[model samples]
Structure formats: C-alpha cells, structure tokens
Target: MTFFSCRPDTERRKVFHLLSFLFLAGFLLIQSFAAHAALVRIKDIADFEGVRTNQLIGYGLVVGLHGTGDKLTNVLFTRETLISMLNRLGVNIRDREIQLQTHDVAAVMVTADLPPFSHGGGRIDVTVSATGDATDLTGGTLLVTPLMAADGEIYAVAQGSLATNAFSARGAAASIVHNIPTNGHIANGAVVEREVPVDLANRKQMHLSLRNPDFTTAGRIAQAINGSLGSNIARVMDPRTIALDLTLRDSIPALSRIGDLMVEPDTLAKVIVDDASGTIVIGNDVRISTVAIAQGNLTIQVTETPMVSQPGPMSNGTTTVVPRTSINVNNGNNAKLGILRNGPALSDLVSGLNAMGVGPRDMISILQAIKADGALQADLEVR
Candidate 1:
C-alpha cells in the first residue's frame, strides 16, 4: 500500500476511453436502424411518371329540358349549334326557325380525364356545364360530341343523359333551388375513340414522382427498394423523384414488387391555422420549447335609451326627445401565468392548452406569440 502504480494508471485510462468510444458507436448504429423501422409502400409516396391522366374537352349541346334552356335571342351560339345539329340529321333546318324553337337546348362544354393505357371503346365519365346563361340543366340529355386533346386531335365521343345534384321548382311568384343547376355529370358517357401511345416496356428506366416532396422520404424509399431487391435497383435522383432501371423481360412484375415494398418516411413539423373558420391543425411531431404565456379577455359595453317629453294637456309646447347613454369596461384581472418549462409532443401540448379553455382562434394568437419569441419549433401558416 506504500507504492503508487504509474504504468497501471495510464493503461487503465486508455482502456476507459476505448470503451466509451465503442459504446457511443454502438448507440448511434442502433439509432440509425431504428429510424428505418417504420415502413410505407412506395406506391403511396410516388406515382409513375408516364402512367398519368390526360385531359379531354369538347363543346356540346344538352337537350330535352322543360323550357329551362338558354334563350335563342340572347345566346346566338345555341341557335347556330342547333341548326348545325339538325342539318347533320338531314332535316335542313334554317337559322330563323331555330331562333323561335331552340329554347329546349343549351350549349355545354364537356370535360373528362383519360387515364393511362385507356384503349379504344373504353368508357369514361364526363362533366357537362353550360357555357351560356342557362337557368337549369336538370333532366337533359347530352348530344353526341367529339372530345379533343390539346393537339386538336379527337380522342373520344360523349353522349348520355345528365345527372345533376341540383333541382329547381318555380311557380309564378316564388322559386326554390338546391345545389348547382347549370352543371351535371354523365357516368360512363364518353367512349374512347383513339388511344394515346405509351411504351412502358421499352423504356430504359421508370421514374416515380412524389405527391409531397421530401428528401428524407426519397432516400428511405431508395434504400428500401435496394434492400428488398437484393441489388442497387432504385436510387433517389432528387427530393421528389426516384429512378429505377427496367432492363428485364418482367419489368411489370418488378415494378409491382417495388410497389409492394415499404419504407419509413421522414416528415417536417407543421402547423396550419384558418382565421375565418377558427380551425387549427397541428402535426404530431410538432414540439414547443419552454416559455411563459398569459391570456385574458377584455369586455366593453355601451347602451343608449331615448326619453320622450310630451306636451301638457293645455300647453302647446312640442314634444322633445333626450338620449341617455351608459358605458362600462371590464378587463379580467385574474389571468394566471402559464409556465411551459419543457418541450412536449403535439398531443400533450394540445391537452395542456385545452385544460386552460383556449379556443382555436385564440390558440392561433398564442402560437404566433410563441413563434415570435423563438419557442415554437415548427412552421406556422395562417390562412
């Protein structure tokens, strides 16, 4: 016990340092693995670039209305369209005759979305809305109209009975209406006439676009895909796109498998507020720092009463009016100070604030104050 060990102390300190370094490395490795545990399908996060929807538009006529169509005197296009339609039907009708009897038809614009790989003779729903000032389109049937793409190429033909959410009943003096009477929908009313060519099999690669862009999500998606396929098949090109090589005979099967694979995605904390409707939305990962806030209400009142003075039975004095007013102010003097000493999750923060009986609009103000003071750790958007 009388001797001091010199070399033992040095060696012991070195061993302790090595052990700490190993412990830190192990902890960080575990954390990295844990972050990737939550899995979401690739299909939910992105869409195939070439596999998308195309827009088609057409101008048509809705007929068979009970005198609720556009007036031919004001809407010249309706008269012109009616005459053209009649001429096509071999009736040889003139414009002057149409001007008097064309009140049963309305000019409408048809719109529809054509999905990818849509073949000829496929059926699609179409929306019909009056281009003229027509009162209603209920109980109307759309005429055969050619739908065209942006390139002036006809791709579909639409014709069917219209279904509308709106109804209007009018008498001589009063009328009641619901929903929109000028618009209607025709289910499976448009038949595809031409197909847009897409070669998914011959493509060298497949591109997926994210509905919501995030760098972390893109990386995680790539990692999960590469992990599932047992090769580096997928890679993140950017925050919003993921690319995969399709150089195999079974490209479709591979794509389906990739869609089935899942990966955890990272998200940013966000809070949204609508001042008009007093709506407040908070993300789950939202965190609040330590802070002190106080809230109270202030009230002010003002009332007025008029006093009348009548002339006496014999006196001829005119009646006089006097005004009496009262004013009061009350500011709540007992708002207790609220202390937030720690950052908490969104749920806990909401519960704590709700206990204080704070409303959504008031919460908006409080959040703004907290943000200005640098205690709120999320993006706040007011609409």
Candidate 2:
C-alpha cells in the first residue's frame, strides 16, 4: 500500500524539474534575441566581382607655371615633347633651335579612374603629379594628353586647369610650403574617348568579394543569402569569396533582392595600432585570458647650464667657458597591478584599460606585450 502511495510524490518532483527546464530555455531564448549583433547590408561588406574601378594613366605636360617648371637643360624629354607639340601646331623647329627657355612648362603624369559603366565622352576627375624637378604645380594647366589603359589602348584625353590644395611663398632665403605643391588634382578633368567593355547581364554566375576577409564571415554571408532566398542559391567558394548562381533566378531582380537582405557580418577580434599617429583601434569582440598587467611611465629630464669662469679679482688667469648639466628621473607611483579575468566583454575590457590611465601609445605597447605572452586573444596589427 505504501509503495503505491509514493507514486504521486515521485511524479510531482519529475513535473517540477521539467517546468524548471522549460523556464530556463525560455529565458535563454530571450537573452539570445537581446544580444543579437547589429545588422548590415551585404552590399556594404562585399561587392560584385566584375564591378570594379579601372586605372588609366597618361604622360602629359603642365603649362602656365611661374618659372617653376622643369629645367629643360637636364630634363631633355621636356624639350623634345615641346618640339613635337609645336610641330603638330604647324610650327617648324629643329633640335638645335629648341631654345624657348620652356621654364614655364613641366612634364607630369596624369592619372584617373574609369569607373564601371563609364561611357564615351563622359568626364572624370584627374590627378596630375610632376615627374621632373619642378617645385610647384599650382597655377598650372594640364595640356591635352592621351590617357591609356593596361592594354596600351587609348581610353581618354585629359586637359584641364589644375586646382591645387597646397601653396608656397619665398623671400630670398626663407620659404614656407603647405601640403605637397608638386601634386594637384583637377576635378572632372578628363574626357572619356573609349569604353571598357564588360557584359554584366549575361553572366551565369557572379562572385562577391569581402572587403575584410574572414572564413566565419564568409559562411555567415552564404547562410544569410540562402535563408532569405532558398537553399543552394549562394555557396562559399573560399574565405573571401561567395559565388552566386543566377542561372535559375531572374538576374537583375535577384541581384536587387540580395542588396536588400541584411546580414550580420563576423569580424575578427583585432587590435590595430598606428604608432605614427598614436592611435589604437580595439575590436568590439576582443577578449583576454586571465592575466595581470603592471605598467608605468618613466621620464628622464636633462638641463644644460653653461657657465663662464673669469679671473677672480685681478688674479692672473685666462677666462674660460664651462658647461654644466643636470639629470633627473621620475618613475611614476601610479603604476599598479591589475588582474583581468578570462573572457571579458567589450565593456569589461574597456573598463580595465581605462583603469590603467595610459595613453594610446602606451596602450599599444601593452597590447603587444600581452599578445606576445599569449594572453590577448586577438590579432595585433601595427601600422
């Protein structure tokens, strides 16, 4: 009778345990939704493979400089090019008779980008940089020059008035310069003479290249594409590329749809340091193992005091100059040991760093040391 009577209590305990599990699962699901990463468009992280910028280069000359042009004596090509240009304009000149000074002219290289879908007779901005010993490019105008592509085919003709962001002034022995005067940019400077041909509508497949390559990100991207459309539409070819098969779907419509889909990209945990600028960039997902960091600043100061030793009160002695210096060092007492626990979130990591009260440059060194000791769980890159 007792054994049969105990069945209700045992069943009640089992039912309570099941209820607890369900409640815990529900809480976890809610937390997962709350902690979701920010959504970004796939177009922001990747681009279509065939859609890219083309580089066009041209050998050109800049005229209308104020005697700051290339010296025609040593830069012989400048004179030769000038003679050829004059001959084209119906003016005859021999090599020996090429003595127009040409000090107001400079040989420069003109460069511009022919963006995808650029057509004939369209204008694009151009950058001109002096190739010779010319000092400044300000107040100069670029001459007509044929811009060529990698295939040695003429793509555009560039000619325009230069607008320089830098300037210079000289007064006999003193001169002040701001920015680089040898290089300048002219907006909408070149006219497109030809077209670079590529058929985008007839492609059976297209590839998406990530700006920042990561395997996890690539997989996530493919999954996002498939989840929005269907299975087998997007496939990962590698860590940096995702191939899209458009044979089954409508080409233009499908591409337009892909751009609208939001995908959460995975970024590698990294710390980038720019020593020249004293800048440090810490990734949001950066982590650290359990470690103790003790850092401090050491400053040394030196002062020079020159003294003159003269003969004192008619005592016969030669006057002399003596150099005196003082040196001092200060080791800051602000240095302290801080223990960091494993698997810190972004806030915790930032809190720990802020507690150290160090500058960006000092933080860069500390991060490098932590990475070397196998404590920092992120890629340390120095620029």
The numbered model that scores best in TM-score is 2
Off by over 4 Å in 2: 1-37, 296-299, 310-319, 331-334, 341-343
Steric clash pairs (candidate 1): none
Per-residue CA lDDT of model 1 for 1-383, tens digit only, reads 32466777888999999999999999999997787667678888789878888999999999999888999889989878888888889878683443365677899999999989999999999999999878899899999999999999999999999999899889999999999999999999999999988887667688888888899898888888788775667878989999887664367777788888877777889889898998988888889888887888797999998899899999989999988889988796777778765557777888777866778877889999988998889999989
Prediction RMSDs, each to the true structure: 10.9, 9.2
Q: Could you say which candidate leads in lDDT?
A: 2
Error of 2 at 223 (Å): 2.9
Clashes of 1: 0
What is the per-residue lDDT of model 2 for residues 96-148, given as tens digits with 9 covering 90 to 100?
Answer: 55476768999999999999899999999999999989999999999998999
Kindly report the root-mean-square deviation of model 2 from the true structure over all alpha carbons: 9.2
TM-score of 2: 0.84
Clashes of each: 0, 0
Candidate 2 at residue 121, lDDT?
90
